[model samples]
Target chain A: MRKILLASLLIPALALGGAGCSGKKDAGESGTQLGGTVHIDGSSTVFPITEAVGEEFQMLHRGVRVTVGISGTGGGFKKFCSGETDINDASRPIKEKEALLAAEHGIGFIEIPVAFDGISVVVNPANDWVDHLTVAELHQIWMPDSPVKTWRDVRPAWPDREIKLYGPDVDSGTFDYFTETINGESQVSRPDYTASADDNVLVTGVAGDRDALGYFGYAYYAENTDRLKVVPIDGGGGPVTASHTTINNGTYAPLSRPLFLYVSTKGGERPEVREFVKFYLQNAATLAAEVGYVGLPARAYELGWQRFESGKTGSIFNTDKARSGLSIVELLSL
Target chain B: MTAGEWRGVPNLARRHWQSLWLRRLFQALTWLGVMLLAILLFRIARQGAVWLDWDFLTSFPSRFPARAGIKSALAGTLWLIGLTALISVPVGVAAAVYLEEFSRAGRLKTFIEVNIANLAGVPSIVYGILGLAIFVRGIGLGRSVLAGALTMSLLILPVIIIAAREAIKAVPQSLRQGAMALGATRWLTVRHHVLPGALPGIMTGVILALSRAIGETAPLIMIGALSYVAFVPEGPMDGFTALPIQIFNWTARPQQEFHGLAAGGIIVLLAVLLLMNAAAVAVRHRFQRRR
Candidate 1:
């Protein structure tokens, strides 16, 4: 009876304590009277860039809070279209299905190009039998039902060792972009490969095996160049290596793609959202380089600011097909 | 024969020496395993001791390694385990009681016994896929804490049931016979005798199962738990992430500092699991002392 009485008393006391804790958190924002929350979610590939921008934005506006989440590109679109998030970070342009869903929900979005990324095909540093690969070889290796199995299968003069393939999982935007550009269709590729949504895992897998080949965002390869070797690709013009200059100048061919941030126009109408998006565009070039991605040219950033400032809505590229091999200038013109 | 007895005595002494050496060898192997674990703990502590702080515990996750915290993930793990224990304990314990006490030896009992054993061994990732299909999408739970907990409950349910069954089986059969012989019904005998006697063992198994649930990341990942959650969950339907997922997200980053953060997170997770196990042992001790 004494224990029961103590428990009864403690339950109410605990309830009061919980209420007091919540009150403190709620009172914190009202004390400053300065900020609202900004929700951002999307591609892991673009996560570093967004996270950097969010950190700076939050520091500038102490009254504001920014939350960034990584759920891959497709997962972000699902939330963005349903009005769950304010901004969506995408590595590739929005697909038609996603755009239609957003339209149906009355979520008008402005697409802004933030940086240039080259999808790099990498091999272990110890790999000695290959220097470069043609687009045809990448296709033969990646295409579904293709019979390419060994290093010698690609070329008779190459080593006869079995080829170990590793790459991004199907959920990744990088996977979709690579497949579309190399295999002539999005989401079309062989089922046999070690895949991970995390680029570091793919990097480790390739780095551990001499016969392995994998591809991911250039930023990952840049960070782990000591362990992995980047392979140049021949795109009918000639073999070209992936670099800031090559990707930005459109010399990287087929693999050079611009990264994007899609903001909900409804979210833009809010003052915090407007200020944060403005801060993002103004500082993207600097922050992009800081995070290992090549920043877009000043003019591109200016155009992006103009588009966001003017309240322009709709995707520039034909959403039915992800437009590959297009320069930033070409995309802007379209 | 009298002369051979002298030789046999020496041979027996030699065999004793060989057996003693084998025992020493096995002892060394057991200590090696413990030494490996100690080395791992020391290495992690050396790397992450400076990084673990109050701010690291309270702050939300950040892109910058210095600013990142596992507050939400820690809270999410608490919510998940609490809900999982609530759902799995009663169901698992009840199932064990029914099988051990009420059910006769039959085909249905044998089938259940075999399947529960198999389910306990099913790879955790398969449970994740099952959770994704049945709870996340089919039931439209949408990656909430409740959905993740339900999936986790399913994943660990088999283990709990198997453990509870063993505890129930260990209850002295004579005690049940005595209660039934004293004019008590089957339910009365189970309630007064069997459950109390098995409670300590059942608690230990349940706690261990929950510790495993707390470390799982794959099923939650498959169900699309966000890697970054700024706010603590206030309700079951809120989106959440767990400590293992947070550690995984941090470890996968290319930056070197995040590796330290992952180590710190691991230390925190181990501490939580250890505390839980300690509590279980304390509770068992209290019950044993009362008896």
Candidate 2:
């Protein structure tokens, strides 16, 4: 009976306490008190930058809730195209099919390039023979039914050890980018190689095996430089290793891809969403760099802000091949 | 001579040797399981000890690993589990009592029983999809804590109901008869006699179901739980992130420091689970002593 009496008293006291706190918050903020939710879902690759931006945005606008989900690039687009999410973070440009779906749903989106991510090719530290690999060599190794089995098969001066390959799984955007660039088609690869969605597993595999060759995101390679040797890629001009400068400057040819944000026109019209997008573009350079991704040039962000403010909706790159030789700034300007 | 010697051996001696070998094999298998768990715990502790601190428990997740913490995720998990328990327990226990004590045994009962058993076997991701469609979209909860809790309730309802039915069934039939003989109504008998007897078992089942819900990442992910929530949820309508999702996000990062942070998150999760189970055990013991 005493417990019941105490509980009855405590409930009202808790209610009063909660009411008091909320009243204080309402009274404390007087001007420009923006309150709403900004929902974002998309690529795990761009998740870090978006998450960082969301965190800082929330700190500034306490009433606006920013929620970010990692549903992979395609899955995020599924939600984005359906108008379920305000913004979608994409590691690659929206596919033709996804664009058609969005158009069908009457969901117009503004494409804003946020960061640069380079697909890095890495090998075991023990392998001393490989100095660089040409685009053709990569295609020869990863292409379906390729005859290259041993390192000696590629070059007679190299050892006769059987080459063991590792790479990202088929579902990943990284796999899509790598296969399209290297094999000239998406999802085309040799079936016998070890594949995992987790880059750390690939890192561990190459670190343990002397004959292993693997490729994953540049961040993974940057994290495990001691255990893995990064192999420079020769697109056409010359071999260039992946670095922040190389990726940002487009020297990392045929590999450095721009990450993007697709914001719905309907969502963009909302004051909270508009403010959040502006903040994201303004701070994405520093946040992207902090998260180990290459930030886009200042002029690129300027172009993005202009495009977003003007409400220009739809993708700029008309074809997948259009992205190969052109930089993000050039594409944005177009 | 060899055939005669084999026939002459005592049958008991051969049976004894076989039994001894079987016992030894079972003992070895048990040891292997325990050793594996011990090794895993040891490795996690070794990696996470340096990272676990007061700040880790107080601060929100950050891009910088040193400043990142599980405060928001921890609060979200507590809210989810608490709300899930509140929603699932009474409904589950009542359903169990109805099926075990009140409902007539017929084709309907048999079908319901079979479906519940099958639902228990269904992969959790299937429930996640259902939750995504029904609660998140159809009900328009918009990825709030209430939506997540409701989805979790659905996911764990089958396990709770089955466990609760067993607990209710374990109550002695004579107790009901004795209460009825004393002029008690059916509802009164159940409330006074059967439910008290089943309380400890029900509590145990509820705690176990809740523990499973706490660690689940797939269903929550399907329901659109955010992986990056910096602030603690202030109400049921607020967006939230849980401990498992935070750990998953951390482990997926390319940085080595984040991996250590994941280990720390696991330690925190396990501690929470242990505390819950201990409370369940204590409650069960008190109820049993009363009986």
Best by lDDT: 2
Compose the digit string of candidate 2's lDDT tens values, residues B149-175. 999999899999998988888999999
Model 2 chain B: weakest 10-residue lDDT segment is B1-10
Show what share of the native A-B interface contacts model 1 retains.
Answer: 0.37
**Candidate 1: Cα lDDT at A49:** 86
Give fnat of each prediction, in order: 0.37, 0.52
Tens-digit lDDT track of model 1 for A1-334: 2244345434644664786466658647566443567778888778788878887887777656676667778878888997878899998898889999999999999998888788999999999878899999999999999798999999899899999999998887889889989998989999999999878889889999999999998888988889999999999998999988788677898887788999999999987898888899899988987777888878888888889999989998646333655567656755
Q: Per-residue lDDT for A18 in model 2? A: 91
lDDT of 2 by residue, A203-242 (tens): 9999999999999998899889999999999999899999
Residue range with the least summed lDDT across 10 consecutive positions in model 1 chain B: B1-10
